[model samples]
Target: MSSSWYRDDTAPPPPLAGEGWGEGVSTSDNPQEERTLSRIASDDAMRPPPQAGEVKTARGQMSRVLRAPLLLALALAATPAHAFIAYVSNEKSNTVSVIDTDSWTVTKTIKVGQRPRGIEFTRDGKFVMVAVGDDDTIQVIDVKTQAVMDSLPSGPDPELFAQDAAGKTLYVANENDNTVTVIDLEKRARLGDIQVGVEPEGMTISPDGKTLINTSETTNMAHFIDTTSRQIVANVLVDARPRFAEFKHDSSELWVSSEIGGTVSVIDPRKHEVIGKVTFEIPGLRKEAIQPVGIGMTRDDKTAFVALGPANRIAVVDVATRKVTKYLLVGQRVWHMAFTPDEKYLLTTNGVSNDVSVIDVAAQKVIKTIQVGELPWGITIAP
Candidate 1:
C-alpha cells in the first residue's frame, strides 16, 4: 500500500519553479509550498505579535487618520460666519456711519467724499460703495480694512446707484445732469450715459438685470432703461417727488414713494404701469401729514414699512392685501429706513430729529433712538 509521508524543515524554501500545476508536481511543489506555508507555521515566528495595548492604540490611530480629512472638511464648510454691518450715508456730515447690528452701535465713522447719500455694499461683500452726490463719483471702501479704496467714474452729481447681481456693473443716477451713468465696476470706468427726465433720485435694476428703473423727482416718472443697449425703453408716470424706490423682495412689483404727493405708487415692472397706490389718511392728521419717503419690505414680501416724514411715523402695510395695517409713531421727519437681516428691527433716519429711530418690527413700536450725523438720508446694510 502506498502512503503519503510529511517532513518539516526549519530553513527557508526555494522559489516557485513552474507556471503550470502538473508539470513539476513532486519536487517543485514541496519547496514552493513550504515557503507559502511557513508564513503561518509558528505563532512566535509569523510576525512580532503586537502587544495587546499597542494593537488597540494602532487601530484608534488608523481610525483617526482615516477620518481626519472628513472632519477638516466639515470644519471648513462651517467657516465664514460673519456679522452684518449697516452703513448710513450722512448727507450733511459728509461721512459714513458704520453700525454693528449685533451690538446696535456705531463701530466706525468713515469719512467719505462730499455729500454721501446713497450707500451699498458689493454683492460679494468685499467693498462698500457710497454715492457722493456733491463729489460726482462713487467712493468705494474695502470691507475687510474699512478704508477708502477707489472711486468709480459717475456723471455730474451722482445721487444714487444700483449694482447688478454679479457686481460687475453699476447704474448711477445723476441728479443734476438728468441721466443714468452706466459704469463697469471691474474696469472702474463709465460705459455710457442714458438721458432721462429731471432730477433722477432712486435707481433700481430689474431682477433679470435686463432693465433699469430711474425715478425722476420733478418729472414724477420712472424711466425704464434697457441694460444691454443702455437706452430708455419706456417711462411710467408716478406720484410727484419720488424720493425712494424699492423693488419687492420677490421682484414681482416696484414701490416708489412720493414725498410731496403723500402716497406710495406700486407699479408692475414688466408693464411699466401703476398697478396700485397706497395713500394714508390719519384721523387727526392731515392728508399731507403722511408723506411716504423711505420704503422697506420683508424678504418674504409679506410686510412693507413706509416712513411718513412729517407724520413722525411708519405705516406698516401688508403686501398681500396692499393695506395699511398699523401706523407706528417714530421720530420727527423720518426720511429713510433699513431693515435688519432677521427682519426684527427697522431703523428709520429722522432728518429733523437728527437721530435714527429703531422700531421693533414685531411690536410695531420705536424702541430706541440712536444719535447720528446730521441729516442721514440713504442707508444700507452689508450682506
Candidate 2:
C-alpha cells in the first residue's frame, strides 16, 4: 500500500465515511456575519445604484457618451474585490493550494491540519470549509481575504461533510467512529451525531435540504438520514468503497461513486433504491483502472462526469439513459471535481500526476492542465 489512491491504507481502515472538499479554521463568533461578495460589488453596499431608466431619457442620451467613462470610473472605484477560486487539498503536503480560476494559477498556499480531504464553500460563498481529520475540526477560510479565520468542531476522522440549504447546520461524516457529526453553523456548536454504517465516508445533502446522505465505505451502502429528525430513514446497498455522492439539480436522483466498484450507482431519492448503475469500458484500459470516485453533472441534468481513479480518464454519461457516451483522457488518478458557477468549465484534481485538468464543458474536452501541489486530492470552485 505504498502508493494507494486513498490515505489510511497502512493500517486496517477505521470504518468508512465520505468527507471530501478542502480548507483548514475560523474561530470568530461572527464569522458568517463578516462575509462579503466579490467586487463588481459596490464600494458601499448601502449606496444606491445608478438607475438604467435615467439613461433612456433624451437629455441623458445627449450626455451619455461623456458620462460613460465617468460611470465606468465610478464603478471601478466602487469595486471591493473577489474572484472565482479553486481550493485543492494536498494530503501528503498537509496544505491547501488556492488557485485563481481566471488565471489558472496557484495564488496562495494555506497550511492546514493533517489529512485535509473534503472541502466546500458556505452557501453564501463567503468562506471555504476543509475537514482536518487529524485535528478533529473543520477549518474556515475567508474568501475575500484568503486567510484561515476560524474552525468548527467535528467528529473523529471527519473526512466529508454537508450543510443545509439555509446554511444553518453542517452534517459531517466521521470515518473512524461510524457516525455523522452535526454542527450549528451560526453558533459554531455541536448539535448532535447520527449513527451510520461502518466506516461511513461519502456525504451530501439533498437539493431541498430534507435528506442527508452518507455512504459507508466498508458497509457498501448509502444511508439516507432525514435532516429534520437526524435519523437514518433508508439504506440502499451500493457497490464497494463508495467514496462520494452528488444529487441532480431537480433532486430526483442521487449519484453515488464506488471507488472499488468501477461503477456509478444511481439511487432514487423518493423510494431510496438503486434505480440504475452507470458502467464504463475503455478499449485498452483494464476494468480495475476505471474505479469511479467523484461525480459532477450539468445543471440541466443532460450529462454527468465521473472521475475514474486509475483510469486517467473521465467518463461522460448520458444522464437520461445512464450510458457511457465518452471518455476524455486526463492526468493520473483523478479524484474530485467542481464546476464554475456559470457552468462553462469543470476542474478535476489529478492526484498522482500532482496537477489539475481543466475541461471545457461545452466541448466536453480537457482544455488545460495546471500544475498544483503534491497529491491534490479534493477540489471545489467558489464564485
Candidate 3:
C-alpha cells in the first residue's frame, strides 16, 4: 500500500512469528482422505470456466448461472485459450497462492510447510514441489487437487533448488549448511550432498544439464558443479551477495545477480569467465537501494528483466547492447517473476505490498495487481 511497508535492503528480514510447522500440517497418509481430495478436482468440472476478458467482480456470480451438467462438462473439456496456473510461495505466511491465469484471480491458498519458497512444477506436471526451509524438507503438492501429498528430504534450510533437464535429479541449495543436497526425483531419496561455499542461496542447472551452478551469498562466488561427478569443477568469483543465477536459453551466457554489488555478472558458460556486467541505474535511488535479486530472460535472448528489490522497479535490459531500456514501477519490494507459457504476460511478486504485479510483456506496461499472501518470494507458472 505505502512505501513504509518496504523493508531495508541491507538488513535481515523481519523475524518470523512462528517457528515450527503448524499443527496438523504434515502429509496425509489416509487413503480415503487422498481419494476424497482427488475427487474435488473432478467435481469442479461441473462449473463453467471463466470467459476471457471477464471482469473480476462478476466472476463470483458465474456459478449461479450454471446450467446442465453436460454443457458445463463440455466447457471444462475444451481448454481455455492459453490458460495456465501460477503458484506463488509466501515466505512468511506458510502458504502457496494459486492464481488461475484465465481469470487473473487467486483461486486458492494452499496450506504448506513452514517458510515455503522455491516452488516449481515437476517435468510431468503431475505435482508441484516447494522447498519448505523451516521444515528441513521439500513438500510436494498434487496439481489436480492442490493438496500437500508428500515431502522430500532436503538438507537443513533448503532455500532454492534446481532440477535436471530430465527432472530426474534435484539439486538443493541449503542456506544453513555450506552444501547442496542432491536427491533422486523418481525414487524420492536423497542421493548425497556436494559441499559448496558458505550460505548458498541460488541454484540453477545449464541447458544441457551437465553443469549445476550455485551462488553463495557469503562466499561471493558461483560454484560450478559437474552434475555427473557431483563435485565442484570451478568457482567464479562474483560481486557481493549474489542472490540469483539464470542462464540464457541457448546456453551461451549465464547471468548472476549480485544483491549488494548492484550488478549482474554475465559469464560465458563454456569458458566460465565473466565477460560482461549488466548494471542498473535509477534516477532518484541510491546504489544500495537498487539491489538486483531475480532475473528473467526471453526465449530469444534479446531482452532481460531484473527485479530491483527495494527500488521497486523492474529494469528492462537489452541483451545485445547491455543497456537499460526502461524501468517499470511496480509494487514495493519486487522479489521474483515468472512468465506465462505463451510469454504474453509476466507476473512479479511484491513482498511488502503483498501482491503480484501483472505486466503485459509486449507493451512493457503494468496492467494489474492481484493481492496474494504475505511476503511472496518466488513464483512458477505451469508449462
Highest lDDT against the true fold, candidate: 3
Candidate 3: how many backbone clashes? 0
| Candidate 3, superposed: residue stretches over 4 Å from native | 1-80
Candidate 2, superposed: residue stretches over 4 Å from native: 1-83
lDDT tens digits, residue span 1-383, model 2: 12211112255443234311112232222322222222222344464666876445677556644554465566556654345789998877888899987678899999888888989988777788999888889988777777777888988989988888787789999999999999988778898889999998899888888899999999999998988898899999999999999999999999999999988999999998898999989998888878999999999999999999889999999999999999999999999899988888899999999999999999998999998888888888875
Q: Each model's TM-score, in the order given? A: 0.77, 0.79, 0.80
Name every residue pair that clashes in candidate 1: none
lDDT score for residue 20 of model 3: 21
Clashing pairs in 3: none
Model 1 reaches what TM-score against the true structure?
A: 0.77
Instruction: Please identify which of the two predictions, 1 or 3, would achieve the higher lDDT against the true structure.
Output: 3
lDDT of 1 by residue, 1-383 (tens): 11110111346664355632433344334343433333323422554656867655777757745664455455545555345688888899988888876677888888898998878888777678899988889998877778787888999899888989888889999999888888887777788888899999888887788878889999999888888888888998988899878888678899999988998899998888899999887889988777888888888888999999999889999998889999988778888888777777888888877778888888888888877787887788766
Q: Score candidate 2 by lDDT.
A: 0.84
Worst 10 residues of 3 by lDDT: 1-10
